[model samples]
Target: MTFEFEDRKHENTQLPNNLSAPNPGHTHQLISIMNTQKRDRFELLSAYLDGEVTATERRQVEEWLDKDVETQRLYSRLLNLRSNFQSLPVPSAQPVEQTIGQVFGKIDKRRRHRSVAWGGAAIAAMVVAALSSVVPGRQVWQMANVNNSAASEPLYVALNTPVVEIPDTVLAPAHKSAPAQPAKLHQQNN
Candidate 1:
């Protein structure tokens, strides 16, 4: 005995050709469904095709599709598009090395620019440090050695003072120096 898996009776059944055709008068129903912006006809058709809708929803979608020529055409186009994309060939090989080299070159260029900028900054900082040490106005204190008994003695002392002071005599008349002779002796005795 031989057994066949195909349903041979289905092929023999005299189904009407118009069974799958959209009804010419259902155009009004299709227009009404399309007018409802809440759910587009395409989405409804897709859900119905996927068997995701309830019995009532499925019936409504079927009726809408049957009535609407434009909706039916859109559904057919979507199905064709899906089939076309599914049949597309996938790429196998990738140019990974070339892509990596381009990325690495960009990275190296950026690193070099960054290093140059950092070197410039370091040089500027060194120049600023040198200037701070050498400039006259910034010298607020000095380490001085004091001599006692006319012998050289090293003394680490911080003297915080103005380098120069204007004397009252110097601000007075030029002859004020002669008038201060007696005061000089008094200062010496003190």
Candidate 2:
């Protein structure tokens, strides 16, 4: 098989030989084994390296490795890679309270700003409500007292009636209707 190098920098450096066997005589046999193709080769090798492979499969890989130089080179490369990773520097830990307080400060600032905005909105609403109540020819605006249980039913009835439709139907009757008769109440003796 012919080898091709696309990058000039990688031209001289020996690549990780992923080849299963190095022997020239067995090259055709190895190629046939590779081409027959079912499961992944790397996965099989990884399982073998981890000692998770069956005894028969282990024996097959061992026999193949015995006649292989490229497989030996790959094994050395994997060993060096593992060793290099193990030698890497680890990052230092930061204090938990410092991290929490920094995030908490931003949240607190946003909350304070929102509270101030809502307070201003509430004050504006109160001023408009007061002015509307005090204006001449305007009906006296009454808020139902929360402590008065008697007003609760009326409030619910009023809420159930659509405000816009009430003006056309209530207060002033149609000119065609005669004077309304009052309902007579009867008392029952207990």
Candidate 3:
């Protein structure tokens, strides 16, 4: 395969031999498995640079770097890449406390909005329920109960039929409530 180099410095350097095997004439192959794939070589060298390899693997990599110019060149390029990444400017970040406070503030606001919405809904329901009984034809629940009772009676009412305890107030008309009595609180020592 043909080799291409973009940089003039790496012009005479070896090609990217990502093959499964190295040169048959190479002495390194006799020492260890130097005939590893190109990806394996890259990973091995990278791990070596990171100091993540075992003692045997480290020794092997060191030998490769010492004997082979290609390996040395690859290692040098990796080092340069790492240094370049390190030299890059890090973007400014929001403080932890500020971020957390903002999040909590949002949560509290949402909770307050939800509680207000629920309270409003409850008030609306109470208003509707109170008005329904007072307004003519708006007593939906009472009418529904009457229809349900007639349907459940089954043709005729017999003495043997189960008696349903209906409240006297239900049959009576609505009446005005008396004034509220002040609550009398009695405190006892525990």
* Top-scoring candidate (lDDT): 3
Error of 2 at 91 (Å): 3.3
Q: Tell how far residue 176 is off in model 3, in angstroms.
A: 64
Total backbone clashes of model 1? 1
Q: What lDDT score belongs to each candidate, Candidate 1 first? A: 0.67, 0.62, 0.70
How far off is residue 166 in model 1, in Å?
Answer: 46
lDDT of 2 by residue, 57-112 (tens): 67755775687676666666766877898899887777999889999999999999
Best model number under TM-score? 1
On residues 1-190, what C-alpha lDDT tens digit does candidate 3 reach at each position? 1111112223433433543357665546443443434546687789878877777677767888999899899999999999999999999898999999999999999999999999999999999888877888653553333456667765856677447876768765557665455442223322
For each of the candidates, give the backbone clash count.
Answer: 1, 0, 0
Identify the runs in model 2 with alpha carbons over 4 angstroms from their true place: 1-39, 92-95, 102-190
Candidate 1 TM-score, C-alpha based: 0.35
Cα-based TM-score, every candidate: 0.35, 0.32, 0.33
Which prediction has more favorable TM-score, 2 or 3? 3
Which scores greater on TM-score, model 1 or model 2?
1
Worst 10 residues of 3 by lDDT: 1-10
